[model samples]
Target: MLAGKYSTLGAMPTERTFAMIKPDGVRRGLTAEILRRIELKGYRTVGLKLYQIPRETAESHYGEHSAKPFFGELVDFITSGPVVAIALEGENAIAGWRSMMGATNPANAAPGTIRGDFATSVGENVTHGSDSPESAQRELALFFAEGELLK
Candidate 1:
């Protein structure tokens, strides 16, 4: 379900999207900076956590890429360290976060975006965001238990 606090503009429904600060972001101590940007964008953080990703969970999370040769590497790197999982609610959150994160590869990202500012490579890009409403629901479910996020 779409979730968020009401906007002052009157009943403008906001959507919930799942976002992540990858291991590199956490290790580099960019969590606060990243979160600050999120809040500045007017997105409400419904839930947040800091933890390590389990192997099985990582596999499940990247299941769609299982057939790709890089799947195993993806799972390994993500599970190697702690990550920050965030549930954000805002107008066009899915698209907004993606834009804010910039391109998957830092090389092609805009100068003001997160990846562009911090990432040096595509494999260890700083952040992750749900690409669509359906993916948002699935991802949010994987990381959060029912009622865990403020509504």
Candidate 2:
């Protein structure tokens, strides 16, 4: 019975990705539901934490946007409250998480997506997922140490 259930383990290539429930999403109490949806998608949670983002870390996290005029706002908003940081492992996890998160703007996000159902605007768009494997590696390392994640 157990082996049968595990038969599909190698059916698809597995990858790791990072995801974050931004401050607005955490404040709105959507953490549990968001995690539920992720698990339902067959991804395994390797690491999870809820904590306030330090200013320095937030800045580093958004380093690519440092020259943007709205960069300060991005830092401020992310550091305003507690956020959920998660490391997930599954088949094509990077792309899978992004698809599940939907468009950057909730207004255009399709229904049934996390942002589509929970976000009200681009500024408060509920979630963040790594856009590629390299990005996933960088972001995951920033939020979680090597020994901190489950194997």
**How well is each residue in 1-151 modelled by candidate 1, as lDDT tens digits?**
2345443546446899999999999999999999999999999999999979899989999999999999999999999899999999998899999999999999999999999999989999989999999999999999998999998
Which portions of model 1 miss their true places by more than 4 Å? Answer: 1-13
lDDT of 2 at 139: 94
Candidate 1 lowest-lDDT run of ten: 1-10
Q: What is the Cα root-mean-square deviation between model 2 and the actual structure?
A: 3.1
Distance (Å) between predicted and true CA of 25, model 1? 0.1
Candidate 1 accuracy as lDDT: 0.94
Local accuracy of candidate 2 as per-residue lDDT tens digits, 1-151:
9999999876767999999999999989999999999989999999999978999999999999999999999999999999999999999898889999999999899999999999999999999999988989999999997799999
The lDDT values for all models are 0.94, 0.94
The C-alpha local distance difference test score for the whole of candidate 2 amounts to 0.94
